[model samples]
Target: MPSISRSTPMRCAATSKRPGCRRSACRAPRRTGSITCGGRTSAANCPTTAARCSPGGAALGEAPDVVFVVADGLSAFAAAKQALPLLSAVRPKLEGWRIGPVVVARQARVALGDEIGELLGARLVAMLIGERPGLSSPDSLGVYLTYAPKVGCHDAQRNCVSNVRPEGLPYDAAAHKLHYLLTHARRLGLTGVGLKDDSDALLPAARTEAERLAAE
Candidate 1:
């Protein structure tokens, strides 16, 4: 599904590092006019609506650092009603050189993100997918990041961050991990099994500060 486009960067001021639910009604009023999608006003009131893609298709400007595409397991109609909205809500906070919306069909596979990313000429691509509901975890989001995405890239060439939700990985932590991976991916010019996530390790300066503070 195509969605509206925005020139403004995505930033959430109220977001905090503590683990807490981040779900809030689309509260930020639009400073700029709405971008239409499918001949209708982008759901500006609903955060997701702001990122809701135009069903008719939208053009890509300069390739963004990352492009987020949604692939949900729900029926097309139902996914459009639910998944798209949720992903759209995060569009504003997704800081990058540029980003755009992409909607995939129901039951789509991970390869779709690669194809879309290659087509859009993005340096990297992140796919937000809905995982099957489980007894303990009913709603979970899975993220896959592919560097230099193109058709025929193997799954081993991508990096995955899974079990993301309010009760699980927490949005802030997930974003931090994603940012870490993206930064390293661009510098190393690669992603997948070879790349490692060491973001949890304390920095040298932080470790020194911790020891000094402890001594006091």
Candidate 2:
């Protein structure tokens, strides 16, 4: 439901990708900062209290290639781990960008996207987050890229990729989707405004990478 005035981005109703556990597993999630866990409503629901968005939502850095934040799972622990786990791995690729803290609530993620775009002075903001946990795709991940920063902008103004766990979109594929979204977002100067397609490129790259890793 990440849409202000645009098409509603799909928010799959699923929860917890913490291996083969009951749907209720990973429930009662905990969070850091003033954010909330367990439900959609959180401390960030208010605009003022929301964590500072933007690549360097708090700092002004060089025009970054792109600004991104990932919310792994709704649980506070999930979000924290998402940011810290790959700190060393993702740091270099994000050289021109400052990785912001992971945020929950698709709406907040959308807000962060706008904040990043406004702060970076870039055309788009990509917020990669864990999708809502559901029976259809509990472990899936989502990526939301917006053209501009404003409240209630709508979903059509953004682009998204979902079902990002093994049985769904793989990490490599998700990365590729991210790569194309960034490139396309730069080219189109808008995500969801007109005709655009990047799914083919994303799946191939992801599959190839997965196969390559398997060979090793």
lDDT of 1 by residue, 1-216 (tens): 332222222321111224652525423323222223321133334433332232233346677777666555322332333333434444545554465434343344566667667766789988767666776756676778999988778889999877666556555556666777877998899999988988546244433443454354
Please, what is the whole-model Cα lDDT of each candidate in the order they appear? 0.56, 0.47
In model 2, the worst 10-residue window by lDDT is 3-12
lDDT of 2 by residue, 158-205 (tens): 777655555565555555666666666666667775637656754676
Shift of residue 119 alpha carbon in model 1, Å: 1.0
Error of 1 at 8 (Å): 8.9
Per-residue lDDT for 51 in model 1? 28
lDDT of 2: 0.47
lDDT of 1 at 13: 19
